[model samples]
Target chain A: MKMFPFVRGNKGNLVGCPVPNAGYSMTINIGCARRSLHGRYFGRGFDSHRLHQFSKGGDDSLTDKVDETISKENPTLDQIRTVKKSMSGAISDSVLKVSKLAIKDGFQVYEAIINLVKDVAMKSARIYMVFKRIEEDGNQIIFSEPSVVDIEKENFDKTVKLFIITKKSTSEIESTISNISEIESVSVEKFTAEGYQTEIPAVASILPPNSPVIKVLLVKIGDQTYAIAISNIERLISLDSQNVKTIEKIEIASVEEEIIPLLDMRDYFGNVKISNARQNAVIVEHESVKCGLVVDDFIKKDEVTVKTLGKIFKNAKEFCGGAILQDDSIALMMDIPYLVEKFSQVLKINVNIGQQHDI
Target chain B: MTFKITHEPFDVLTFKLGEKEYAIDVGITEMILGKCKIFKVPNSPDFLKGIVNLRGEIIPVFDLKSMINLEDRENSCSNVIIVKIDADKTGFLVDEVTEIMSIRSEFTTMKIVSANYIKGAIIKQNRLISFLDLQDLLVGKMSAFELGGKVG
Candidate 1:
């Protein structure tokens, strides 16, 4: 008997074989065989009587020659085996090259796989991802392993299906999977990705959940530790040797040609007299007003997690939030906009004129 | 005259001042902040200890001892009770929060008329607890503004 032929059957039936229609589907498990999942017709047509004759025929070459049945609705067992070999060859020739490049650049095999999937899925409207890894043996012959799937067929339904499982839009996932290398075809149902629990590993452990890492300038006044967002600071100026002039009761620090108003935070911290040594004036721009915050000392810049103050401290305008240091101490995070407004109200000194006379 | 007392129960926070225990309605108490830096506002009243930054709000803190004409003593640990009045908030310096007491209207017996701020006296656990009326406390003082006294 010629191994399963490429003959078209009815809509539901793929093989023109004489078998009970109820038990028609069968899965072929191959350990080292390169197989194409186009199980589309791999399981059809070959009845027990003919299968018995083909195994006993002793024509091993006939088992490997079915390459023409790529789109054949009723493909023979030999054609299915040939499709697997064809897919394995394509994977080794194209997909494996990209995977090797990613691996060489310090990316893990899994990460490379995710990136490849994302790249491929960007092109099509197929939301379901059905993938089979191709393994290359020592003889350089590529073989198909078992189908490795993150998503399944039941997920194709509109409710609690593919879209909801991945927490991604149907169109987005469809396009991504459609773009996968050597992917033949896809079928799906409408769905949603909202509130889906993702499997991707979160980036940093030190940062608070869902909060972005931010750089801040730490300033110490007396016993209090305060952090100002680095983006708000213009520069740090040393006032030890520079001739700091007090104009109109506001200390002035000369930087190039600009004179900025210097206000000591220690005055605001309390009546405690702390030694002002090795202190650098932090120059910050508030609205159009440029002012310097004279402090006791400057700690190195650090990345911190910002948490909002509780309702009890809701009225605290100068402090927008707080960050926990490595030592488990709370460092108050300054609200620059509010601080500037408060300084203008309390100091009675004009902010616009702080830029006038060149120190 | 026998006054009818309402059966509704309310909570009050009791704290120590000198040798006496004072109570404030828990409804008006916003928070109990730990020791913090209190900046002294210039030209303020003597009862106004200073202004402390609770979170970021600058609230005037009043010395409870001096506010009631008692001898001012050094508070080893400065615990501030942030209270809301009308629409504003102010902080009052206290030694520490003693306990929370649930009291009915019938528990309050005598109303002190010497100062309008004193609501009445109530006996809790065999000790006399005086209730301080926050509204009258703010309105009675002409120098309340100097004490960071905000009406609300």
Candidate 2:
């Protein structure tokens, strides 16, 4: 509890008196560092030094000033604090407090950002280490066996496990670690052959390759099975109930309330004959514009693995990729965005509401 | 005219279209699958027989008889050569798969009736078997007939 004396200066600015004998120069320097950090990192217009002086004064008149500055800086500072807490390791209170103050001054974490959400508390915190595999000249080196190395704990009181590695990206390690669960903390320590030690950090959550099971609506078109993302579908309407009108040479379906142009996928694919009359019309929305897809029959919705098409169909934008069905058959994944854009042009359907004057 | 065996014998998959026999490199032929149901595509070129689903892979079927400006004789052609061309798996519809005959590369000459897709001709079993470019016939080039238009 050191007292910092404030003196009123010209232009109503309160200047702090330099107490040389108080041995609080370090604290003043820390305050100055925080001010520079806040200005540089936070991009806020005001400085924290002035706010610190105003807060230390305990004057009722400057209370609004302190509150205003804190209110303005709290969101960004809290975000930084939250990220720091997400990092794998038990961060000391002094480090957290200092980091919070620094963050309030606008310290941004670039290389590593820890998400301090409820699920990522200290007990279940995930630790990640980033390693730089590539050099500037793009020379290659054989990767050490087992890319992920386990870290060891030295101090029993520490919640973080320290890992040592030679080379690998921090992001890659973070993604790999995120697939795992129920970890207290992780500390990645890198020791170069030159005896210099560097600490790289990362945060974790379930990443791609293992996650993101996509749901696609499988449809039977002729003898082919096609899949479209269910998210794109607005509603499934039976063809028997609606009268499809041909407007501007485009087949438009007038559902209960909305008028959507129907795109026959068989026509688009150039199938010679209709094996069966299309039973359902799937209203698809793309880029805020809605259209209908008439299909032979609707198959059950399934969560399948999406496989990208080979180079032959690289120019075929209509097919986004292919999905392997449970029965070991490939179903072409439809690119709704491409189909909507292409058919909309062919049918001369107006994309915007006001532009439908030609219709 | 027959030439000397200047090259080693290589296998060519022979198939019939209309009155002529066509041969394609065996490497390009996946399998000679019998005629399956072909779904006709409206507004597609006349040569396109529609599409066939083999197992789970949907392959676009092209009529070889139509490509060479020949009339479809009847429903006699019952075989489709499922060939891999570049990245696309396409089906080449033909009347019949005659046999796999080994012919020398030298015996196969590009002197057959000049066509964009016809590579040459090989004298196999006393018959002039036209070497057809299956890659060019199927997934290789986009012919005018393959152009899809708005359905009527």
Candidate 3:
């Protein structure tokens, strides 16, 4: 299988470097060509011979250096062997580093390519080609259809799989793919032009015409019932005082081997009487920072239309907005991310202050 | 021989807060709503009673008693007077809305008080009614109220 080298500071351009042979290893030049040229080659199936030619033309300094050493008059066999071994070692090291980088930055590169394709599709009015599956031999089998492409492959192989979205007809695409000897097979499924018009509008109309309804986990703290968007909540767990631990005056609870900082809703909201009743904690993740919000009880999850808290409450950061419940009572929607961030910062400050007091 | 005293009589909606009577211009009053559930907002000042969902619109209810530092009676306030200041609608929780009466300009006097919200005092009958400037009370004075006060 061929391995693609992803160079750092190369602006996400996939530099195709053929794996070195047993001897006479080729040195890789990390400098990549412009994005336009990369896109052009990527859109057309990658021809290994053309890629090799491109790499050779881009830089030949290292290769030329190795050539000059071998071409030296009366060069010993031992010297030649040493040079080959060193070249092989150097190429192997570069390959290992590039492979690691490729794995780490693979998702970013995929996102960038997807965004690029979206921009192109918006401008050209071309539909996306669905990536159907990848064969055991690393050949990506793509199904070309009109609109809504589903990508099934999680892991990628050496050959850069290009989903060439185009306005061209199936016959035209098939003829183009036929010219590229690298593409093993081309399957054409003819969709009528009217199908394209109908499908595109259907996709656009799928978005709700009215204000979008949000599903929220209704939670009660004190006399007030608040709604936390279900999307922000990771899970809900029952908690007792035994489960809670205080570190530097900050309450934390360990759930499933993960220690989460807890912010008591009753305490945070300044409820006069702190209840000794059984409590539940809603584990919420905001921008990857996890925090557990302690609440008195959990009501059933329901979909509600959130209305903005008027001008007077415009400065209230604790609540994002409020939604009228079925009982005609309004439940304030908790701003999860903001509260998590604010709570974390407060705990950090308190911990620091405690440390200073000890000092 | 008759003495005709010509003075512009503007309407004022009078409401009771504790033992004191407060009046705001009737023109600013949107509607007087009965006792509805006021959802307590976290990290809000004491003067901010809570938010009320009237129809579909969420309007903030301010405790007028707390704003003016009057002794707060327990669960006595049922009337929420919705007033429009500029483009914003705000609700004031008071004991009760007594009346909407036309008070002549002659009865009103510019009395100096510590509270900047009170524009003047109108002497109606034997009782003195404090004329409130709703704009001055609610707008640009949010920082004056202590934040993170207990919410019921």
Candidate 4:
């Protein structure tokens, strides 16, 4: 009635027990060993039936003594070892059949342990390889968390997500990841520093504290370059001289089914009329009033820091400020709102004069 | 207050306006630039030359010869003197910056001239150098320009 001893292998691999002299193979149930180890490690109470399985060897006296030792609420290691020693004599045999069976079981257990160790080592090595590959591609693993799950109850699948810090472009990193066959997918997201609650702020807002830069469309008027604030611009249209109609000497152009007054900037800047060159008009809006500012040509758009023209030019209402161009030349920023307002007033005055003449 | 004449050598920057040499206090001068582009402002007075970009700051430049009623001649001068007046900065187009001279207070003689902007005259090395009162010149021109700008 004495139960044979079973050694608990790491990661729930059950080491088979040796056979007794009765020509019967006995096994310590895997569930029993697992339960005992689980109880020992995880502090769970062990049930009497799950603690051990008795062998049918008919040694009642030794069985009663071992049972008496193991029946306590918690059996110590020494008591378990004593039970193992008492059962060893009956379980061991000097015959080749018994020896061969025992050796086969030992080989199976040894193979299971080796396979477990090899599995863990392979996983760690693969993780190291991936980390090295990322570093070689100019990326650093800021953090990594790996998890293993059972796929189809037959294979163990490991997935690792790595947070990488890199200066390389997103396309470059994507290409690098694509070359590695083991990578399933890649996701790129913008990263901000800790305690940064909102998304990235606008570039203008982050510039020098009090002086914010403004985006402007640079246009050529006569020989000078002028910047019109992009916020005030409605659109840019090519000036068609045939479509331009004059009412009471006030030039107007129809755009988007609406007629808007056109102010020739060449005349305003005192440049001689270029009769042969084509002109462009910038449709600008201010206080719900739209006007077309005619210019010689359209230049590029840029972000510029504006500086005020000092007291001497304080009365020059047509210019709000000036910006230093990249070429070290200055481009005056046109006062779009003021210009639109003034154009509307001129139109009103001309219309009034026409009405007076008709009356 | 007592009138005491002491020989304290104060620095003055001399520059040629026309055929004559003029001096202004060196402390008020910010910088001297050579041959930079000046952008003409529309509807401004004739004496108000234009505006110039002085290290990203827009300062208006005035023609010194035209402001003081000198005879109109071919202007080949390219020197500009940036001066700070009160809280504003302005530039003046001059023919040439001669040199920085330290003139004693006693060498300056109070004299009345046709141009009210001349505070006095300084005798240096047997040559007459007019000491310019820049505050009166710039302020007077600014008011006149402002008046004309308002009227136009």
Give the number of the best model, judged by DockQ.
3
The native-contact fraction of candidate 3 is 0.52
- Clashing pairs in model 3, backbone N/Cα/C closer than 3 A: none
- Chain A: TM-score in each model: 0.37, 0.38, 0.41, 0.41
Name the regions of candidate 4 deviating beyond 4 angstroms: A1-210, B1-8, B111-114
How high is the lDDT of residue B96 in model 1?
80
In candidate 2, stretches whose alpha carbon ends up further than 4 angstroms from where it belongs are: A1-213, A220-225, A239-261, A264-279, A304-316, A322-332, A343-359, B1-8, B27-30, B34-61, B82-91, B104-108, B136-152
* Docking quality category of candidate 3 according to DockQ thresholds: incorrect
Kindly give the stretch of ten consecutive residues in candidate 1 chain B with the minimal lDDT sum. Answer: B143-152
lDDT of 2 by residue, A109-213 (tens): 112222222354332113222112111112111111111111111112223221222134555444544444554333332222221111111111101112134
Instruction: Residues B110-150, candidate 4: write the lDDT tens digits.
Output: 54545677776777777788789888898888666543332
Q: lDDT of each prediction vs. the true structure?
A: 0.47, 0.48, 0.54, 0.57
- Candidate 3 residue B128 Cα shift, in angstroms, is 2.7
- Alpha-carbon deviation at B9 in model 3, angstroms: 2.2
lDDT of 1 by residue, A255-314 (tens): 889977677777755546565444577888767877788777788798876653332242
Q: In candidate 3, what are the lDDT values of residues A1-359, reduced to their tens digit?
A: 11112111111112321222211113322222222211322222111111111110212444554556545654432343344333321211122222223335331111001212212322111111212111111222211111111111112221223323233455654554444323434554432111111000101111111223678999888888999989889999998788899986578999989999998888878875455745699999987999999988899899887666754664455665676788888888887765786676556434433433332
Greater-TM-score candidate between 2 and 4: 4
Using lDDT as the measure, the top candidate is 4
